[model samples]
Target: MTTADSSVDKGSVSAVVGDKLSGRVALVTGGTRGIGAAICGSLAAQGAAIAAGFSGNVTKAEGFLADFQGRFGTAVTIHQGNVASADDCRRVVAEVIEQHGRLDILVNNAGITIDKTILKLTDDDWHKVLDVNLSGAFFLSQAALAHMVERGSGRIINVSSVIGEMGNIGQANYAASKSGLFGLTKTFAREAAFLLERAGKLSDDSVGITVNTVTPGYTATEMVAAVPEKVLDKITAQIPLRRLGRPEEIARIVHFLAADASSYITGQVWAVNGGMDM
Candidate 1:
């Protein structure tokens, strides 16, 4: 049985929470603030160690570490790096493993948007969005997958957007990048299972790796806060819920997928949108 598949009895409750994610190491990019921050807190509450990734904001990074340690009282280590850089992605994974001993969950939550209409979008704008949003997820997943494959157990979760499904004005580049995640996630999901089977890791009672995506609607985050009030109101009116999502709402689903009981779930996209799909 894999680490996640191992059964825990009442006596082991102090060691690892039953049916919840515990004794796992998770690495989350863009994890210091916004939606990523909420994800970290959710996982930490379940007793997982966190390796929070961020760019180069020293002050914010320091505060993030302090706050999480105080709030959840869990083990957390912050890593600074550019997710767009493949070298940085590999290094961060290595560092996390070195610090935490092993990595069990990887959340590709870091993303950037360079919104502009197709006609107005420049090559740099398109590439930058793709590099950070799409390619960053790929590079980081690739590195994480290598370690996961060797160990024969892990979970990779990608964070996408509702805008990827319903395209918006002046966001052609952003939409394309987010949409690309769908294919990326599904392919990762299939390939992970195949590799595990090839390595002779699967059995009637044993489980292997899983990969999935979480598409969140416009949430009450700093990024969504930048939208003009009129524009935000129009967006809200389209939702069946008649309001934006909470970061914790999205975090809850992610926590589910990361837990031991979700072993059968893989290659799926969980959309936490209001009614945007309809």
Candidate 2:
């Protein structure tokens, strides 16, 4: 079925077409594949200009950018950078603002995983996972917040994982990073709310911002493709839905939170895991 007809394709949060996000710009880290790419495509379809940030993988980034521009006729830009690096995060966001003039949405979706017992997991493994998964989000959000605060409006969506909420067998590093992300989300939400409240108290007419997180379950992404088929089947059997979720499903939620529909929601974690741990 076309995405238009599928239940998963709820499309944009905008009730009207063509101008739901008429003047908004969004940046998604690691937006070249899997859920990240899906969020970009979905947001573009909703009329938002999109900027995609990637650590490497120029080929995939270019291809997706072309596909998005061709399909939706929206301007889509791809940026190459190490999200774990504070400098790179600033560069990516600065370029986007230079091109589009403002930043409205930021999704911290780039992450990595190393599966091994703590006994075997090296310091390198632990640090790498935390660096990409947790630190990347912190740095990018910090940079983006500066712009959003200046504009007096924005949305930040951090992509966490169900594993972070309910610990997995051999994902100590991944779990810690994700759990930290939840904490980060809370702090961001509190800070944004406080800033907006203070602005309101001062009787300023300014657009406000919201921050939230989405934790996805086992999806058919490249990372999960690396798992053994038997392992995949075993994992699927544990989900209440008896299946894996599509990237688009998670993307829809991200888009909603990015849009005005979720203006009242923040500091929350939405789990798209098909009841995997429930």
Candidate 3:
């Protein structure tokens, strides 16, 4: 079956990069695979230390940790946490800071999808999706913000989806969860700005704190690969570019936002949707 895809491996470093993110530490949820893995590689290529978060895949996480460190030649480790739990969220942040000495960037990328029509969707379906996709990002961001606010600078980058804006069939819960990030990100950006300002820490030289979201349209990940060929054809046809997005495409934008130069940009959603939406 012909899938709208890219030739690059999600975790491979393909682009030319410099040490722009050097000395910074980034925590990426679900960073062991798919789009998340690509983001890790992108940041690592920019010289950022990585704390890759995975939920339950021990073997995969360990493999990713070893491989990522070898490939990037930077300090890299895997973190295990169920982001739906607030305590776990806090603990993960604390661990990252403790291990890395500080965390400069956070990518709330962990998410799950259980597809079922509304008539067949259970209470667990809706709640679990909301908890993992929406609440998880919130708790993680909240935990990270405490340290960021103390330091007067940090980056919170949320990975949302076009389905959130376009509302896919059998993805009502997923859509709501991803859409919720819009408000969460903007509010956090505002709060971070206000806090830094109140502390008299916002200055021309200050790196400052910022929060933003990246919403990707249909992307060529394992999840998308599982879709039937006909469905993929339909999806590609709707996309103006007629192709699924590459994970690296999404990762590049995230790296851009995580860099020091992006201090002035916040509370915005950067869409890499192949012109799926204007």
The candidate that achieves the highest lDDT relative to the unseen native structure: 3
Please give, for residues 181-250, the per-residue lDDT of candidate 2 as tens digits. 9999999999987876776631234447889999999999999999999999999999999998999999
Worst 10 residues of 3 by lDDT: 1-10
Q: Where does the lowest 10-residue lDDT sum fall in candidate 2?
A: 1-10
Clash count per candidate = 0, 0, 0
Off by over 4 Å in 2: 1-18, 200-207
Give the alpha carbon lDDT tens digit for every residue of 1-278 in model 1.
00111233435335223336777899999998999999988897788888899997878888888766555545788899998899999999999998778999999999988777889999999999999999999999999999999998999999999988888899988888888999999999999999989999876665578899999999999899999999999999999999999998998899899987788999988999987786
Candidate 2: residue pairs that collide: none
Which residues of candidate 1, in runs, are more than 4 Å off?
1-19
- TM per candidate comes to 0.92, 0.91, 0.94
lDDT of each: 0.86, 0.84, 0.90
Residue range 193-214, candidate 3, lDDT tens digits: 9999998999999889999999
Candidates ranked, most accurate by lDDT first: 3, 1, 2
**After best superposition, candidate 3 residue 91: deviation in angstroms?**
0.6
